[model samples]
Target: MSRLAVSVCLAALVLAAGPAFAQTATPQTPNIGGFPDSPAIPAPTNATYPGVIRYEVDATDLDRHIVSVRQVIPVTGSRITLLYPKYIYGNHADTGPIQLIAGLTVMANGQSVDWRRDAVDPYAFHIDIPAGATELEVSFQWLTQSDNSNWRVVMTQRMLNLQWEKALLYPAGYVSTGITFAPSIRLPEGWQYGVSLETTSFENGLATFAPTDLYTLADSPMFAGLHYRRVEIDPEGDDVYINMVADEAANLAATDEQIGYYENLITQADRLFGSRHFDRYDFLLGLTNQMGGIGLEHHRSSENTHAPTFFTSWAASAGSRALLPHEYVHSWNGKFMRPADELTPNYNVPTENSLLWVYEGQTEYWGDVLSARTGLHTKAQALVLLADRAAFYQNQPGRRWRNLQDVNNHNLLGYRVPGQWTSWMRGTGDYYDEAALIWLDVDTLIREQSGDRRSLDDFARTFFSPEGTDGDWSPRGYTFDDVVAALNTVEPYDWSTFLRTRLDADGPDATAPLDGIERGGYRLTYVEEPNADEKAVSRNWGSDFRWSLGFSLAGPNNRIAAIQWDGPIYRAGIGAGWDLIAVGDRVASAEVLREAVTAAKGGSDPIRLILRNGQRIRTVELAYHDGLRYLRLERIEGTRDRIGDILTARRR
Candidate 1:
């Protein structure tokens, strides 16, 4: 084998037999490959690497829902420390996906070999090689989904979204970027593939990608299916492509107007971040409810998995359209100009998410803005999304105990928290929503300080737009000081203190956030009837985000997931996980609860609630008389509505 891909282990199915060939040799104390303490396996050098970790991914087992990966590694050592990827780049809940890797085995000289796992690192393996072996190969089956878990590689009869790290192993010593890789895939016959990768060849059912470093290779994922279509969204040689793979060809058929909106999306994004970091960009979309459902950002592309009707049922998926723009914006913000610590050399390094408030938060801010600016979302639709997100943070009781910084760092445990009493006890993704509010304040402040001469657009162009695009996918890191410096360059002020005060707060002070909303030319108020965005979100969760009543329910059953701290429900001694037994004479479904709230809208009538907390049942009278108080971003009379201007502003 060449000495590039895997510094692999080799064995001849030969054994140094002693009394070890006994029956007990395998069962209880199975043979594990290792090397002598002296003259340890020679450290693989940078110069000797063959420049590509070649992978031949076979998806023929799609019907069986398994993907077989065969890897060839160039090695010189008698042993290689190989590990499945761990600690996903931006996920705090990293372990949830790593376990999906199954049936991993290493081989040498076409013979099965024994490999030992490092006791300390669950993902690391120490493989043994027979003397004189120059290369190693491994074949493994990665199960698409676990028995009953949603966390798995998405592989269906129609398409597949390959998260490379989960399916391949790499040598441990070198930085992932320093090592090179060339990947090729053999799809089930007639299936076409779309990826941001530079393709070297494409022939019947097989595609080869240009050689890339380990980091870039892993970052470049592919979406392939029997039914696929690529729509050019930009006229500049179609630098932007909407690569869609759906369960059926009908889903691939999108209206011209719908497709036109994406073209504007590309235009607005180009206007926001002055320079393009990628040579080519793809919005790799999977319109399949069969599997994958989140948008992950990459340098040249975004993995956008949404409901099957992402195009056809656009209105119903109102708020979700933001996912695409959000991940796309990350190519400039989170992927290009990242926080220094987050720009790790390899995939295994734990991410320091303390700045996610900026990484994800700012992206969330622009995601909403750009989505609206591109006409994917109406201004009202954007406001609904912002208000919903804002109300979530304002009502989050955990924010009182944990500041935004701590909330940002909560991903250290991979976002795994007990469900009981989660509302007040735990913080979920506040950085995305809450940070959006904070950054909105920053944008408004920029306009205010600059006498409306500049806005956050100036900030983005200043920080992200380089003189030229390096055409490299690897991230260029930044620091907190770098962020403050950039803001200062736009308009001089105590940005350090300004951002620190907002992010470091540990109290439920609505003054700053409310003021920020007002600055956006709207006041945060409530109205009757949940908007389409709210109702759409409610229908999915089976409950309403009744910021007025202060609780989110588990749905048609009206069981509470959480109650806002210091809110009326909390004051009434209500807690999470309790069943809303009844509202006066009616059994408490979300409808009854809303009706009860509506009935008490005009007067100081007390709504009597019968709640069941485990074995105890109690009656509580909540004197909340604000009519169906759904949060809204209503116009502040005669105030400046710069939101529209902010959405369209660009450097001329």
Candidate 2:
């Protein structure tokens, strides 16, 4: 079966059979202004001359998540035009076919002019006006969801006004090449400001920044609200801006520490690249009251979200800081150079780009390594974390079903489902996990292959060198073939098979590129041991409880749904969805009995579940593993000179 089909089926089954689970509930139909249909809009034929641009946005309806915008573009030559991005970045989807542009009135020289929606791509909207018109104004209203606060404009209502996060307004002529932004924000009192851009505050709550190039403009994100702290670093060249916007008051000390961490990360990246790609970079922290965290990279800035501080302790905070290194490195991998396929079609339509294992996976590996090497994390701690990633891939069941390349290419559709499944299995044999291991393996291999002469640093320098052809990776992006060819220049070995097995095939024998490590006279084995910190954290939670309510649910058929953590069935070693036969001492109705489990709690209740494994019905007792569930890492010194040696030798 195709991997996509299998993943969908498995997800459905798990969702139906598993215990109660937590997930981001899809919001009700947002007040997304009005639904805009692309097909209904006519396409543009002729090119119109560009014009001077000025924009004004009034976003008072924070509760509705809507805004009114007025834009004025000056016609220079033949045509005057305006366009709305058909697709919002980071969303990886169309803006819900929603039209924020309601009552889009267009006027030229103070007279209403006939205009039509010319061309529409998920990336942008095109509008045409009379040629050589001195100026034009376009006004519209945009509607969105308040909870949606990653990329694009978002607002939160508190007290009497709406707060803004990730808002940017640009003149229509500029190219969106992920640049630093300079915008003018006008708001009423009781509002604060945060941006990655250089800004000057004026009277009447107006903020302005000098116009920067298109690339620089894309790199800056703006946040306005009452909940933020500005930390200035080194006033030598403009002020290094660190804007932290959280839902609650932040601990100044912690915020300072985070700012320092970012400073160090930027320095290390700059040192490695040997060039400051951007005049200024902004790091905007959007603290949310959510469970998940994400970091999105732009040319000069990154937008990040963090969990609630109360839920995250110092150790957790330190660990979360690892995201800085990861996103900062993107200033190279993703910002300066990116895969063409991803940059072109983007997520509007599915394009086959399988090199995310290199872009994202390798970046992930290096992000952590650099963090440790630069003292952001202890070497031992980093090593343990790497080992944990290895374990996760090795334990995941989905790894048996899909290869890294397949996962990368289909990440938009299958990432979460298979990802969760892989996590559940505690497997570290997948792409991110395996790529990390292989990087360590290859780093070791480079050293051994060159008799301690060369390292991954050498390879990276060559691969990412400014003069290198691969360095021109943007718009269309590079491919595995491109990366392989680059690596081959450093090491003469044929790496085609290595890429195919780990990245392409999902079979059981898909081992990591460990042969090189092994060839470097090193042996590697993964072992699990008790982690004191994890145990301590879990101990405070309470007794580990696992419970299972019997069900023979299929995703489309009678499959599993969700498995609650620390539930009775989970303790009995029952997974989310296995075909259930008998419950306790009788044939229990899956639906009716599940309701009973929810209604009842701990009372030394023993519920026997008979489930079908493959074809045979097997009975297992569910017992929760008390304490916080954490994966532990134990590595034995192999014959190899660390993992890096093995990879080095293989390259040679």
Candidate 3:
């Protein structure tokens, strides 16, 4: 029925029944319904945009940390909309910093054209084209972050990282791949830069890149610095370059042995995946303490940052060495073979992350495996790292309510916020580590079911690197059913039930899935001292008392860095961010706290701690005493060492 006819009939029926129904109840306060939702911004379509967008950025203003931008967008309609990039791909969130764009102006045909932001979608700007106007001139300034307190400090005194999405706007109503962009940039004179885009021309400090689709342009970022060096790590196969940039020249000193480890990384990855995706890969490494750390993955390249002494002080930077391998594996897992829901056509569309357990989880597993295979960490260090991860999930209390599958949505819910109640609320990116353990379970299960003939390596080759479709970096989306089918292809079994039990189970009985550790012929054990990996990475980060006193203290003030969810410290009513004033009678120090913990062990005495929370000072007594516990993995006797076997170099 038509809307008017249906409404008339419904109103008549309501009046007919009102007299009878009203006699039984008293009149209630009237409630007003909400207005209809504002009209949706234009949905993206496959139609191509009319003309290429011209985008240029002047990033030489280091002192002010500003990126001046000019974009010329061709138009075909009288009224058009432009959208700032949101729902960024790598970040998997609506994290576009639109507030940073300032002083935006649009002009057409030598006259200013008025523009208004959409009332519903603030990321969109609507403007009317003047009569006979062929294009619109848009200008804005992107205020780059100056401090590392919350956001990345992209522009430092000696270098800058230019992400295109932060500096340009795109036309709505078309897919990102259907729009083209000719991007160019101007850097300070004498600064060298590295990017994935093919440079067409360079004059003075300006460089113009070849025209590319908006998708690729947004994915490619530039790293310019006072000191730059590009070295080819994979010369035997496809060219893979590591573009190293640093605040000072001496920080670029990468020894030959250290570089060889990276070369072995490529060789090991080739053996695992059995195919290459990108034609050429670029590893953009920024060795700096000036810029905030990043480990974002891209289709053809990855953006990464580490300490300035990452190479010069090799052993000290062991914790960060896995970053490169992790991002490198994403080219095959996240970028090429992607989850169907996460493969959106444009940046504005929301992504469903149900399959992130496989997308990011397996990548996390392989990153660490490859790191060990390439000698980035010794086998002992690798085992220690594994024990640390296993122990973390064992102590995680949030799993009682939040399952592994639900943790996948954490990128959207919390982004990067590390809540004070970590073990209960769950920290950001728990899927990365917890899912890695689940994959380990899957790997060990496959080995056991197939009688050692097949493992996840076979599944990776069958699912991600399918034959006759290699050397192609184009995305291929897959569903959850596809994952099960591929696993069945490797070894026919009830894969669905296995994955669901680990992914969906909850309540108090839902401990972390440790079948993988036992099946891999290893057991998680505790020791009085931490292993090599923990000791190496704890240089600046303070003491670890997680296994003993249930909290950790850091910084010179002895403030609690983290507290276990249901541990002794939590039961004693102590929360994170409280500064320790003294332990018993002695003034608080890391050593003094450890001595107290050790002395209280095997005795009936309680540990006394004086703490300051804000302006209030109180003495709290901890009724538990466990002395300095640390995690370690011990090999089970007379069983196959599948984890050790997996860590063995496949190429070697």
Give the top-scoring candidate (TM-score).
3
Global lDDT of each candidate: 0.75, 0.50, 0.86
lDDT of candidate 2 over 215-283, digit per residue (tens): 344445565655666666533354346666666665323545645655666555544555444556666
User: What local lDDT score does residue 131 receive in model 3, on the 0 to 100 scale?
Assistant: 90
TM-score against native, each model: 0.87, 0.67, 0.93
For residues 1-652, write the lDDT of model 3, one tens digit per residue.
3334545565556556777775675554332331133234689999999888999899999999999999999987688889999888878778998989999999998999999887557888888789999999999999989898767899988888888987889998999999999999999988888898999998898999999999999888888888999888894665798999998999999999999999998888888988888788889999999998899998888999999999999988887789999999999999999999999989889888898889899999999999999999888778877887898888889988988888778888856676787788875567788889999999999999989899998998778898887788788999989999999999899999989999997898998978999999998888876655668754432377877888888788998867998888888888876999999999999889888988998888999999998999989888766677887788999999999988889853
Task: Give the C-alpha miss distance for residue 605 in model 1, angstroms.
Answer: 5.5
Kindly indicate the candidate among 1 and 3 with the higher lDDT: 3
Cα TM-score of candidate 1: 0.87
**Counted clashes in each candidate structure:** 9, 89, 0
In TM-score terms, candidate 3 sits at 0.93
- The residue pairs that clash in candidate 3, if any, are none
Error of 2 at 552 (Å): 19
How does candidate 1 score on lDDT?
0.75
Off by over 4 Å in 1: 1-48, 146-150, 416-422, 426-428, 470-474, 507-512, 530-545, 571-582, 602-605, 609-623, 649-652
Q: What is the C-alpha local distance difference test score of candidate 2?
A: 0.50
